[model samples]
Target: MINQTGKFIVIEGLEGAGKSSAIALVNDLIEQHTGQAPVCTREPGGTPLAEKIRDLVKIADASDPLSDEAECLLIYAARTQLISNVIKPALAKGQWVLGDRHNLSSLAYQGGGRGLMPLVKAVSDACLAGFTPDLTLYLDIDPKLGLTRAKSRGQLDRIEQQAIDFFERARQTYLQLAQQDDSIIVIDASQSLELVHQAIRSQLLHRLPLLFANK
Candidate 1:
């Protein structure tokens, strides 16, 4: 059922998998196809308040451990604001929503990478409350290469600076979810940008034909 609302698409990947760029490309493609600019935004900063929370969470020197549970809650908090302020309103107005990151990040980062699998269900169940993406693009990449690219970009955030093992687990977990979930499409971001964009466009066209079709 096309529930009288717009579809929500989330772009997910490790730090340097080009999620931001892919999101911009996807947003543009959606607009070009649908003739309406989707509500494009990122997590932990979609809303002004949430952006503050993001800064705190990303601070490497913060005394707080930012426990997996806390991290999950903080992400949910940002998501709540994002849903209320951006997502729901856009969907109600029949505008597509393209999010750069979503709960999947916490799932892979905390549950898989940080070895907090047990906390996954609790936080996800209580916090998410059935709000799931219609489609998730997981840009898969090697952690070593991804981190190197990330380093070149600039200084790393707390999570961005995590050890190679951490990101390896994160990437693995994302791939695992892609295997298990039909909604997730895994793309090899190790390829060149042009190839990656082509793959993503193809996948989006195949999965969201209605959105891309003649209106």
Candidate 2:
């Protein structure tokens, strides 16, 4: 049976961290064990308005550059829209919520990478209040390797196009935050896909036993 309180699980990582595959694994596991599919959502998206904001945040224009503060606000704006319209509503109905790159993405990219922690923190405080994920799986990988993988996919977006040093800083921040938060589990994303998937499954099963009570 579904639990009385819905759980929010977020997958966080830098570019090319295999978040899509991780999300798929989590969703499949939840359905297999709980017999209920989670409501999947992605940051800077999952809503019409949020999607438009995503476009604005991604499309690069060298001549008309976006300031760090502006970028930070845009991200939070998109997040607020998604949370208010989709995430919260789905959870209220006792449905699990699976997120691909939530608040942590902003903390890593905009705050750590772009050096806008104060602005990001202010926006997060004002917008999200104390909202947090029940379980966060952070995929850790070397910035260079991750960037190479991302490049193989296609042209990098504005954020993805950042320098390797930027991503390294982001990775460090992710690691630090993971250590501080017991709910955040760090996974070695450099491993083989199967191994990574297995690790994710193991962590989920360990952290959220209630979801797999029937299994």
Candidate 3:
């Protein structure tokens, strides 16, 4: 049931909000509806150049640390490559793009965490030209609990190594933006895995019913 047009859906959350599982859940539903797999992407690294930037973002040098402004620029650079070379083309060709994360991450992480909303928004507007997802599922979780969960996986990345206050600030930004935008929906990720999945499913059914109508 591949439609003539494609939709872009993004999943947003801090570390350890179970984004990977949530992505799998949504991807399965979309595949079932379209009878094909959507093009899956992750921010900061969907393309070859983007992938390199993603590594750089995660493992910064302690010698001359990346400035907040510099980090924002690098992210947008990666995003530009992803959008110009990957995401936009996929959408234009009537292929659904399922993104692991998107601009929202920047707003939350860089804008809120680093107190650079003005700079991040400016860069976003210049780079995206108002392009955005059809639907965004935000998995909300407590930063402390989320980081604890993240810790079990392995060593934290440079971004993940931020202080508790930084993540709290980011979470607040995520909530504020979600409240302002109808396209963004917040799901309580603090719930059990099954419950989280259930909420995500219900949201898809409510927000994008057509995708599930035939299937």
Candidate with the greatest TM-score versus the true structure? 3
Candidates, ranked, lDDT = 3, 2, 1
Residue 187 accuracy (lDDT) in model 3: 98
lDDT of 3: 0.91
Number of clashing pairs per prediction, in order: 0, 0, 0
TM-score of each: 0.92, 0.95, 0.96
lDDT of 2 by residue, 1-215 (tens): 44556788899998888998999999998777657898999988889999999998999988999888888899899999999999999889878899998898888888899898888888999999999988899999999989889999999998898888999989999999899998899999999999999999898878777543422
Among all candidates shown, the one with the greatest lDDT = 3
The candidates, ranked best first by TM-score, are 3, 2, 1
Give me the runs in candidate 2 sitting further than 4 Å from their true place.
210-215
Model 1 superposed RMSD (Cα): 2.9
lDDT of 3 at 63: 98
Report lDDT (CA) for all predictions: 0.83, 0.88, 0.91
- What pairs collide in candidate 3? none
Residue-by-residue lDDT tens digits, candidate 3, 1-215: 64647788999999999999999999998887767788999988999999999988889698979889999999999999999998899988978889999999999999999999999999999999999988899999999999999999999999999999999999999999999998899999999999999999998877666543323
Name the regions of candidate 1 deviating beyond 4 angstroms: 1-4, 62-65, 210-215
Residue 112, candidate 2: how far off, in angstroms?
Answer: 0.7
lDDT of 3 at 139: 98
